[model samples]
Target: MNQDLFDNVRRLVTTAAAGLAARRGEGLAEVLERLAQQDIGPGAFREPEPRSLPVLRHLPQCVGEAMVLDPRLASAIASVEDALQWQQSASYTDDLLGAGFSENYGWAEIIGPRGFFPGDDVLLGLLMLGPERHYRDHYHPAPELYWPLTAGSFWSRDGGPFVEQPQGAIIWHPSMALHATITRATPLLALWCWTRDTATPAQLA
Candidate 1:
């Protein structure tokens, strides 16, 4: 692992986690720690040939609104190159799965020095969960934030009924809030954050 890179990501995760804690505490602390340790940046991130997936939805509401509230947040996203990379082989059932991610899920570590809005160590970014035929219920150990850049996706949490989140829907899940999603008609795309406890990834119960 690159110590320099780790330091950068750690700083970012810590800042972002702190920010997320203001709105949501405890749940995100771990995610922040985990992200701080990764090296998923330009070095490991690959640039692939141009290709397009069949289904994808655009994010609405938040991007512009966030920019209006905090112009710097919008600008921060530009620094992380891998944030937009088409990950790869998200789903495998002949076609894509609803929550399975059509391509490999991508995370751009938008929290550290090179990222947007310096001074903030919060871990946040744009994410794309390619289409899956079906998305099973899974929950994370950290507080999570979701601002779907795409539309027409359903979100549900532990025993809770599913809710259709259109673009710009601010969805929050406290730690261990069994959540599951499904995409229909088209592919689903959204922004996601591990907030804190960066080491923890969601698991299907």
Candidate 2:
């Protein structure tokens, strides 16, 4: 394990968490408070096998936009992009995401059971969706918070119609609440966290 790399990723996670903690919105304060109680010591982290998906091809462009919104967080992620292990949810297969959508969606766990830092029941990561893609409705036991770094993305919760959200927007999904995402024209990049009840994987609605 690269100690320096681990330290850098840890810094990025803390910086991003602090940034989210500063936000004023529904569910933000509660999630931030829970995050504050976690132990993020180096001992809690272990390097995992690195992986990537085709969607990552758009990462640089999305990160470019993210840099404008939050340079510290964006730069930190860019610095570790090459070393990060990007993966996708097993529940979302090509059949569920539509014909070619599977190729356009991917996520990387920065802090979780299988991530750089083994989270104490908390999960922090990045998610990306390519242009004109639909993630479809899905839900899990863990409550989720998403911080979209780029624009042109739409969000829907509990089977509601999708609504456009601009860069730096914050969206939260309560436990098992059906949620979905859509992107048009431009790719989508966002930071996500699952705070508590992390054992269950997401199920398609």
Candidate 3:
């Protein structure tokens, strides 16, 4: 692992978390505080095992738009995009989501069990959904927060109707809350985190 790259990612997560804490309520503030206290030493990170997914084709555009919303984060992410290990949820199959959707939806873990930096009980990563795709409701033991960095994306929770959120919008889902996402004309790119209870994987609702 490149020491400089690891440091840059740490800086990005720290800056983004602080910015999010300032704009969010007490719940998110608490999560950010806990995340700040994690030990992200040189040994915490390993060389990423990169994987190419269809959704990654749209990453350049998403990163370009994200630069306008959060320049530092966008730059930092872009700098290390090729080094991140992109992966799809194990539970999602072609039978679950259509073949088209399965290929075009994936996440890149930045700080988690399989991420560049192994988190003890916290997970931070990026989620990408391609244009005009529906990511059905799914639930997990870990409470989650999503910070969308691009436009034209819609989100829903607890089986509710999806609502469009603008750039820098934050969405929170308590543990085991059913949540889903949709992308319109543009692809979706968001920073996501799971605070605690990171053992269980997400299950489709």
Best by TM-score: 2
Per-residue lDDT tens digits of candidate 3, residues 67-133?
A: 9998888988888888788888787887888768876899988888778788878988999999988
Write down the lDDT of every candidate, Cα atoms only: 0.50, 0.87, 0.86
User: Per-residue alpha-carbon lDDT of model 2 for 88-197, expressed as tens digits?
Assistant: 78778888788878789988888887678777788888999999998888899999999999998999998999999989998999999999999999999999989899
Higher TM-score: candidate 1 or 3? Answer: 3
* TM-score for each candidate, following the candidate numbering: 0.51, 0.96, 0.94
Assess the local accuracy of residue 50 in candidate 2 as a C-alpha lDDT between 0 and 100. 82
Candidate ranking under TM-score, highest first, comes to 2, 3, 1
Pairwise TM-score winner, candidates 2 and 3: 2
RMSD vs true structure, all candidates: 7.7, 1.2, 1.4
Winner on lDDT between 1 and 3 is 3
Once fitted onto the true fold, the runs of candidate 2 whose alpha carbons sit more than 4 angstroms away are none
